[model samples]
Target: MTAIDIRDVSLEYGEGSGARLILSDISLTVRSGEFLSVIGPSGCGKTTLLRLIAGLVTPTRGAILCGDRKVDRPSRDRAIVFQDYGRALLPWRKIWSNVALPLEGGNIQGAALRERAIELLKVMRLEAVADHYPDQLSGGMQQRVQIARSLAQEPKIWLMDEPFGALDAITRQQLQDEVARLAAERNMTVVFITHDLEEAIYLGDRVVVLGAHPGRVVEEISVDLPKPRDQLTTREDPRFLAHRHHLFGLLQGH
Candidate 1:
């Protein structure tokens, strides 16, 4: 039940004369146990906002709170899954060990660590590749491995930065469904950044659209669709189409 509150957040690069604002007074709420989809143009500061929430970086003019705690730096309670699977995973380490990396910090070793890693890997459908290295798996599989690693951390919040953008259409859609299911089942608070409108609608409980040029929230739409969203039926639903048309128009204007 961890909710994220971003208050009048703003980020700037450089300083004084050279300072360029990347985000300006961007404020929004991610409800507890809700899947929030953030979509915008190429330079909308979507990733920057995600990084701020992850505490990988700090806001120059505002505060971000996870529940009641301020986010000035990274915490174990938050886990980030980046789009670059090649860099995110260690090719040297086997899949099981990669998934086990976070748990090792807590001195959770031997059978305990193995069991936990396998449980998460199984959840991500990567149990069969436990003995393989990152190089041995496909791009989609590697992403799943990264997700398993994130799950091992047992974070209160899941922050993803266009994680499925690198995969093919079929693979991306498959992983999209997997992610949606995982978020709902575990009740993990998620903030997903993506450029895909359909992907955003399909996965998010609500979608927040950001306008470019010193990125700011322009629109927030609640997806009134039912749960257990099916790929075929959900996309074909009239409501989904309507949301798509309206969001498309909004993005075009931004």
Candidate 2:
């Protein structure tokens, strides 16, 4: 089953003489329940491609389909977890309410909304901080809350834009493991964008490498590693290192 299908997609910014093409004829398919991570040089249109699938941006050409439906604008089936956790969370609302915000004005309310929010918070190990405001939580804790909120929506597809980029090494690794576990448990189809090669390989079923200066797919590598992966064991595997080297060479234009 295809969760996301991008066919001959291209995105251009500016216009006329000032026009700059960011993505050139990019095409990819994300399978249902698959975790895909996109890696590229700094200026590449990795985020642009992600936004296109998220219905946050329109492609200059080609079509983006999500679960057989064309994506022209944002839909409830998709949720984005951005790198800026503080920006994603509401400073005024308590953690529980923030997690439940997506359910407001629908059917869920009062005790039921609170119950779901608290349940998700517990999944994130944030039950103790349910009443805390965004300002009260640390960076890692804040990001966790954002993740819980995103999960609370129970989105079928998750588009993560370097969600753990802002964290320290330990926190990043910790969350990386947690994310992988949670994604598998929820059977989510994820499209993750990251500059970290190891993180990409560790989290993704397949890693797509994009080259900048007119961004395009340079290489696509299948991890083939067993699931329930851990950072130490997976990273230490010889095959993992080889794939990392291949990506490094691709990024170097070799």
Best by TM-score: 2
**Candidate 1, residues 140-204: lDDT per residue as tens digits?**
99999999899888888999999999999999999999998988888899999999999999998
TM-score for candidate 2, please give it: 0.98
Q: Which pairs in model 1 have colliding backbones?
A: none
Per-residue lDDT of model 2, residues 1-254, tens digit only? 98999999999999999999999999899999999999998999898888899899999999999977899999888999988998989899999999999988878878999999999999989999999899999999999999998998889998999999989999999999999999999999999999998899989999999999799998898999998997788999998999899888887879
Residue 44, candidate 2: alpha-carbon lDDT: 93
TM-score of 1: 0.97
- Worst-scoring 10-residue span by lDDT in model 1: 105-114
Off by over 4 Å in 2: none
